[model samples]
Target: MTESIEKIVAELPSLKNVTGAWAVTDERLARGDAVFLADLGIALARTYGSSRQVWQYRSVFDHLLRLLATTPGRDNAVQALRLVGSAEVAGRKLDRYVTSLLASGHEVADLTAVFTGQASEELRACLVHELVLRGVVVEETPGIARWVTSPHWSHHPLGRLPVRLSDVESRADFPNYGAHGSSHSMPYGPLESRAPMVIADARVPSVEETTTQAAAGAMAKAVANWAEESNGRIEARLFVFAEPLDAGSVPEALLTLGLECLRGAGKKTELSVTACAPAQVWRVLFAAASSGGAYNSGSYGAYGRLAAWQSMAALAGCPEGAAVSEVEARVRDGTWHVFDADTEWFEQVAWDIGVAALAPGRRDLAVLAATDTD
Candidate 1:
């Protein structure tokens, strides 16, 4: 990857500008922000021992770079890049370009030109080319640079197969989670026109802190509002992403609290509860599917959604059909169960499929070998 990046920088005459801005990025990364480092570590860990994951990481890294570069000027871009570049991905720095940007004031001016509206078409092309070579800028349209994010663990082993009919969306399209504060939000996809949704941001002061009554009250209010507007059927799916081992009882308590509140509201509420590791997309899907609700697994969540969707789609025996949704609904309706002590076995199978997708001989084609029945 370093060799590829070097080759790109060497070929682009306007490389001076791109390199200088990256130097500022390097300085920021060296400071060691905890959150940034943690995210970087997860991204890199998933990619280790698997080339497919490595490419996925690269795609996301490049997408992040383009976003930082889109900042109005050198300083802002530097700040944005610093916010994301702490990861130890290969070829993060453009060696010669960084040296040139630091040593020559004239080169810094050239780099500034591209971001500050002083660049020529040729220079812009050169910068764009360098980015493309590194997998940062996926496409360029005149003044616009279209960026892309690689799938996260949420979509995993399935690759990028779509669950819904209108799934042509980009992964980099959602608002940043850091921007939304620490509260939880709802409606994993389009309200489905059928499935009731509730996402509880149950983060508390500590593991001993119980917010079951408050969460139940919130859901009751939501159910009441929805009941007045709709046909009055309240089928609520509660997903709890809890942090502590002892905290597992919180979701259990909510089930009782939720049922009691539903009785008062005079509405029949089919409540389904799922508790899993905090901040994981798999648990969210686990909650929805295990509860017999429809799971979208769209661009809004992590990388595992895509992979899960693909695997479910295949297991349902309909590659191009809406079988993924059907299976989710079945799981919600108590027809299928996707979690247990055996889940690790399924995950291992999925990971093998993913590794095979990046086969050394033919990486371009999407092929899954057939099983013999003889």
Candidate 2:
């Protein structure tokens, strides 16, 4: 509904610190790098796909994005993170502060002092925030600026945001998708453990391209994974958003989305044979087949395994859930795992998971996919 910190962070680049410099010579410069890297990390964290490559915690990136996009300076956001993590303010204060800075060259030294209660860190961080917020600081080594904002689309990831738990679980969290995850789960919290994840580097496709690909890659992969993991014990579900004609034509694109994300990560996955169920009967007949003994009526694959299913979204028989036919989703472990994402659908969950899209969307559909022939 509202713009996000990730939207802005997606514009920044993930910092490797080529100098490998442990520290910067000057404090403000260091703070500038901190803010810049923070933005880049946020975008990287929010990217979607199956990369599973680990890096610095994405929350740090998102927290910094919240700081830069919402707070006026580094120190202020530091306090903001505490307040943010501690349930003080929902971080809107950061947004308001940044809005003022954007309209009128504002600085955060004052608020930084208010937050950290220390004079020096406040000054250093605030200065860094000021420069970056105004588009001055950047990662020119790669010929890139530190931060900017853009949309999450159906693919084509140039990118990239953040949010809370209690607020998220409430109806106020994401009205459209509604509240879907844990308010306070476990070691799985952003604190103790990160979910299996990846960063996206995809670009946007036209409606035709999106549906074709969404059904193929995004939709298919989600299904393939579930079907492979849950095996036939569970029936995968998808929330199709397009009209009938479009759904019928998306098998190829679905394959594209799944294969690209898999191969992009150098996994060398293969597209599983796809089976379609007519929308009317909503009938799907599963065939247990994998050239290398990957699937059968008896067993599922190992964890994080994927399989591609590109045909059910357009099933005209459409179940009761199909009333909201605009999107496709998977029913997993009693939870509706939706991943048919565009810019809008993915905003809350992916960011909450510390992920950004290689592309973007609103409709979240769980794409089940599979690993290939051994």
Candidate 3:
């Protein structure tokens, strides 16, 4: 197997004679040779940075993606995908392939299930994210959604902040800390008149009672690691309010809390707050789950999705053993009030600073402030 695959890889670079080389590879691939597929996958990874130009490798990618769409070739193709990380490398071609596979009547669950037990958790998460990016709505099954949305995978891929697919399409307008950062706040209409208001005479929960320590810890970690650059720092804190306030007052409330959290740490500054619809918040969290915090980059896989679910579960205080779909349903139902703000403390690149969410009924507000020079 090794010698035969080596011959194939060696002959592949002969661009003029590549047709004959692929003819041999095609015959072997058609027979469903998993070992050959796996070896070829590894070889493809190595070949990516070789002296040959990228376009010359198109045949290799085409074969892998073609096999990826077929049932017999699916698992081996996934293993190859794991080795090559083609979701990042192949980009649109991968998207078109996945899209075509789905259009051809392949069940999303069946395709996603191919990744189970075949790849590392992180790779699985990234693959799933790639599938979602192609507009595939993955089923919320234990093997699929649960793994991707778990918080355990969140810390491994640093600076992976997921955003909605729609947002990804309009990424030009999406906020980031980069040169293209948007100056405008996230636009949403006035809060619904029927939206729940803060109870009069309500008492703020103690730091200990506002939210579970685990939730707070996860939020802090997420905010701190939201970006890849090392020059910036992020702080996340949860605040509970007990005073009488309406949706109209959330910005001021958030501003007050923001001021308190930033006190003594740096120069005092005021934050410009904006009200975000619950639907928008849901999309952000959903994007996180779908893309594993990759922003517009192709999916990183399950960790981002898992972390988003875990964060919501912790915030809404969902019962143990709750289904991810149930949690998602609740989030989409406006159980949380969301807001984002900006301040001078950080060079507001992206939506890094002044992002916060208030839990339904409990009034627990989670605030994240981030500053990134890069």
Candidate 4:
């Protein structure tokens, strides 16, 4: 963990380039695997806004890992990791499918056609190996497996395209020092910036672009290494997508960029990047869910900051329309402050009561915001 922290500090530039640069982590409270990923996650969290609860989940996972590892009957850190690692493994599969489609210029879900006869578990294992050695394909999104890129698309002797392949390589912990972002903007666009050639049309000057690239590159490397050392037995991959320079709203964009960066790993993995921050992606996801008190039910790509907003909004009973107006009124009246992650949980909890917008029945939401939220 110390080594990871040192590495994280070294990669601080790239870590800061993330959209939630203001985020923080309590490494002292973390341990085990979660502790290992904390610095990198915290670094990314700062650039990409994240909830303290989500941040705390690292501790939760770490605690579980230690317990699993220490179990006397039949210690099975590997199997117990299934709780989190299984989800990660599934996510990697999603990456392979999406990246393959994008690299081959296939449409979403349409790529499954390529597997009509060949999409076997064995083939998937082989494809996983391929993605481990090449670094050409470029498409990544969070949780959702959508792909884009053409690392394997080269003209054949007959002027025909041969088997399209995506390349990937892993040199985790790349560092960036000069990245810059002030006010925060989320990165959300359609599949226009496909793989092997992702270009964010940020309306920034040349110097800012240079700094953003620098920061982004550094963050990419750190994330890659973290994923490499992470629960690899579970089949995991790392990706990093680019958001508009310093776009504060970073939840979705961060996850998307993370997927893109995974292709950088030396291997041919089929994965794709779905462009969307959180509002649209997550709200829609909730719309598809089976419950309101869903845990980790939202898109891993976006909605990282929803914990804070949802927490405060519920505490104050602030509804969407009139509540927003009331919150605005409070701000104008100096009765409330901008949703700040500047203090302790107790402070935030106490402040919730002062806001007149919070109403009944929303404590469930607030409970999630504080305990199971994020």
For model 1, how does the per-residue alpha-carbon lDDT over 1-374 read when each residue is reduced to its tens digit?
12223333333333333443334333444443223423433344344414553443333344334333332344433433233333443221222122112212122333433444433332333343233322333233233332112233223322232222222112212122221111223213211132222434544322222224433232222122223333222322322223331232332333233332223221122222233221222233322221112212122222223333443333222223454456444323221211111112112111111000111121111111110010
> In candidate 1, which residue ranges exceed 4 Å CA deviation?
1-75, 82-184, 188-305, 319-374
lDDT (CA) per prediction: 0.28, 0.26, 0.46, 0.25
- The alpha-carbon lDDT assigned to residue 216 of candidate 1 equals 27
* Candidate 3: stretches off by over 4 Å: 1-38, 43-213, 220-232, 258-272, 286-301, 317-342, 351-353, 370-373
**Evaluation by lDDT, superior candidate among 1 and 4:** 1
**Which lDDT tens digits does candidate 2 get at residues 1-374?**
22234543343235453112112112222355333443343344445212434333333333343333343454434443333222222333333233223212224333333233332322223333333323332233122222122132212211110111111111111001101111211111012222322323333233222334433333333224324544222122233333332222233334344332233322232222223222211111111111111232111110101120122322212232232222223221111111222212112121111111111132333333222221
Residue ranges of candidate 4 with Cα displaced over 4 Å: 1-105, 108-112, 120-338, 344-363, 367-374
Worst 10-residue stretch by lDDT in candidate 2?
172-181
Candidate 2 regions with alpha-carbon error over 4 angstroms: 1-21, 26-214, 220-367, 370-374
Quote the lDDT for 294 in model 4.
15
Clashes of 2: 79
* Candidate 1, run of 10 with poorest lDDT: 351-360
Per-candidate TM vs. native? 0.23, 0.19, 0.48, 0.18
Ranking by TM-score: 3, 1, 2, 4
Residue by residue across 1-374, what tens digits does model 4's lDDT show?
23444444444444424222222222332333433433343343444233444443333333333333223222122222232223222244333322222222222232233233223332233232222223323134221123122333222111121112211012211111111201112211112322332334434312111113332322222122212333111111212223222332222122232222232321122223233222232222122110111122211111111222232333333443233335323323211111112112212221111011112221111111111111
Better of 2 and 4 by lDDT: 2
